[model samples]
Target chain A: MKSNKTNMKYDIIFFAVALIILVFLFLAYFFMTRSNGYICEIKKDNKIYGEYKMDKDHEIDIKENGKLVNAVVIKDHEVYMKEADCPDKLCEKMGKISRVGETIVCLPNKIVITIKGDKGSDSLDSMTK
Target chain B: MGVKSTKNIGITSLFLALALVLSYIETLLPVFIPIPGLKIGLPNLAIIIVLYLYDFKTASLINVMRIFIAGFMFGSAFSIVYSLSGAFLSMIIMTIMKKTKKFSIVTVSSAGGIFHNLGQIIMAAIVMENYYIFTYFPVLFVGGIITGIVIGIIARELLPRLRKIIGFEIKGSE
Candidate 1:
């Protein structure tokens, strides 16, 4: 009897919870679908370092061996890491970014940037704008 | 009642008490919450133990009650709105997976841990007072998986003795 009454109170509690989870899932789905951008992939030594959103215009100058090489954001959808002095020149071959998941890495200087879809609150432009 | 049933209930209660203790202990852990309701799930150790030693039904019942009471007494009880939801989702996932072939104690416990975190995130998002949490989810998802695996192994080791205490024998004889 005691457990049942306690259970009833809990049922009401969980029901409220169910409603909340549903609301959040709806928001996540909405926010995710609303954002359709690209990611800038940066790799070091063929290893993925991290990814950043490509929704804004930012300048990154790749300096290898203390010399300015490549720095460009191709488009809202494409990015290029060209004009590096590295002998391998693998990142230059990554070409243009056409999709959400693309990479531009400079291994010699130990810097990489990958374009990913919808990340945390670092970039306020998406929500504010 | 029969000795078997009595023993089962006893074991379950013991786990329930253990979970309560772990829950209280976790509450004391340091939190740097620029956002709300975010913390590492530690009571999950008991929940995982329950899922492994007892059946899903028992674990579910205990988990629901544990979270409910603990939330009120130790946490923001009035915020049943968040606690119940997060705890329920976590318990449900853990219970369902408890019986699956791919669902070892480790996997189920880890799922519980991850879901617990996800559930809370969902609630926080709804209280929708903040969007900062939405940004760090990728980090949370990967973190959830890692923590789940670690907690899973701990639950797996504790399962055997727990089963015996509950008067249930492990398969494959003594």
Candidate 2:
């Protein structure tokens, strides 16, 4: 019983320290990864489907064999999944992405939307134009 | 000696069966969280129990067999990859904590849970080739802690009762 008490004390200390470190890491990662993104690149089945400018508000319907599978919305310089036929609908609930390195993935549909800062002067000009 | 080995094998297989059933039950439950790979990790109960009752090698054998069997039964090839990574990582953390003997079973299990989620997240990042998937880390970390504590409590309660019935000494139980 005495040994158990000492074990409990150490366990609490260990848990508290681990909790603090993990919380710190979480906050640090969250803040460090936030940045302004310029383009939203959508990939289907690991292939680049299209890249859209974040400045424009538009809806993109991804189709497969004449059936709509997913609907992506870019509005107010942020992108989100508006609708999806996937079973889990996790992508739709993933909220918005407006920063570089942000991504929304639908594994069932094999669709990935990633936010990129800039490709290059030439590609950026062509995309904007 | 032969009889003892046979008894050990019997006990290990029983725990493996229990773990497999728990895995199947998990698949039947509806997705409560929107996170892709998040689960309550019910099968960890059997693995933890086996670890305390036997040794790390025995626990690892059961865990690997459970993941492969459960993965084939209810999941895809991709899921097998995720489970193997998560389970292996969690087991290693739990083993190290258990060896230290400074922490209780619940604390060890909680650590296992946190690392398990981390391992799966790492695998997700690799497969998707995007580091952004890690943004889900905070949520998974919290979830793992909660579920780990729950499973740990259950295992702690079950351990003493199991030892009484089986009439065997546990490795690291106080």
Candidate 3:
């Protein structure tokens, strides 16, 4: 009978609390880690493959387990997946990224390329408060 | 199995087919987020419906089957792994929430959505062997809330009408 009860008020209060908690968590994490210097961090097979300044354009070929899995290109303060051996090529299709939190992920190749800014905030950085 | 059980299977299959179509439609829509593993989760509607109608077991079956069928149809071999992890985790969380009877459909769905993303991120971390994947968590948490609310609202509106059409006794718990 309790399970069959449809108390609309209870639902509203419960979700409102849940939402507040999520928003709180998001804000806490966002403010704690916010940056905008454009640091490109690359990881392969769970290891730090390399870290490059976005301002310095270059290409990286990552080989894991004795196989060339992904090729990445960083140019013009932007990073993108240039080539991948995976079937979906979703990583390549992810397009160029310049923002602080954008990432290019190649699942099959076990590659994750993320853009993180250095220790300075841009004037337009909204999350900083 | 008896005739009644067979009938349940037949109806469940129909739900599976509908879930497959919804997932295919989702793939066709151009994803706004360039990030991989973010989806509007339209197929969640079917799972929610099955959950409210029958029980967790039926919902779980439909959830796993839909991932397999829809993955092959609209995604790659790799996507199948991601979705299976996501859908299974979402179903378990949602079922637990629903049984508690403390949360509304929307809240349950929102939680389900968030856990769905959590499941995928966990899988990605394992498959990619990278813990840095947690950095994407904040954005995905917000996305899950938004999409979960939408799916929950849709399921709430559809469930009553669907029950009438099927003419099944509204029994709570298995």
lDDT over C-alpha atoms for residue B84 of model 3? 84
Q: Which regions in candidate 2 have their CA more than 4 angstroms from the true location?
A: A44-47, A61-69, A83-86, A118-129, B1-6, B168-174
Report the lDDT of model 1 for residue B96: 70
For residues A14-112, what per-residue lDDT tens digits would candidate 2 score against the true structure?
Answer: 788878978897776566456688888998876888999999998999999999999999999999999999766888888888887667888767788
What C-alpha lDDT values do all the predictions have?
0.59, 0.83, 0.79
All models, DockQ values?
0.02, 0.36, 0.34
For A1-129, candidate 3 gives per-residue lDDT tens digits of: 555466666677767776787788777656544555478889876788899988898999887677878889988877888889876677888888777665678776667886776656532234422
Highest TM-score: give the candidate number.
Answer: 2
Provide i-RMS per model in Å: 15.0, 5.0, 5.0
lDDT of 3 by residue, B1-174 (tens): 221665677788889898988998887888677566888999999999899888888888888889888878777676888888988898899999899877788889988899899999888877876555666777788888889999999999999899887775324212
Model 1: per-residue Cα lDDT over A1-129, one tens digit each? 866566446435544554575567556644543444456655544454445556666556645477786565545556776566654455566566544323344434444444556566323336533
Candidate 2: give the clashing pairs. Answer: none
Residue A71's lDDT within candidate 1 is 65
Q: For each candidate, what TM-score against the reference?
A: 0.51, 0.83, 0.77
Q: Candidates ranked by TM-score, best first?
A: 2, 3, 1
What CAPRI class is candidate 1?
incorrect
Instruction: Identify the superior model by DockQ, candidate 1 or candidate 2.
Output: 2
lDDT of each residue in B1-174, candidate 1, tens digit only: 221665556666777788788888876776543223345666777877766655667767777778877877776543456666777887888777655444455556656666776786676545533333454454455455566767778777877776565454423223
Lowest-sum lDDT 10-residue window in model 2 chain B: B165-174
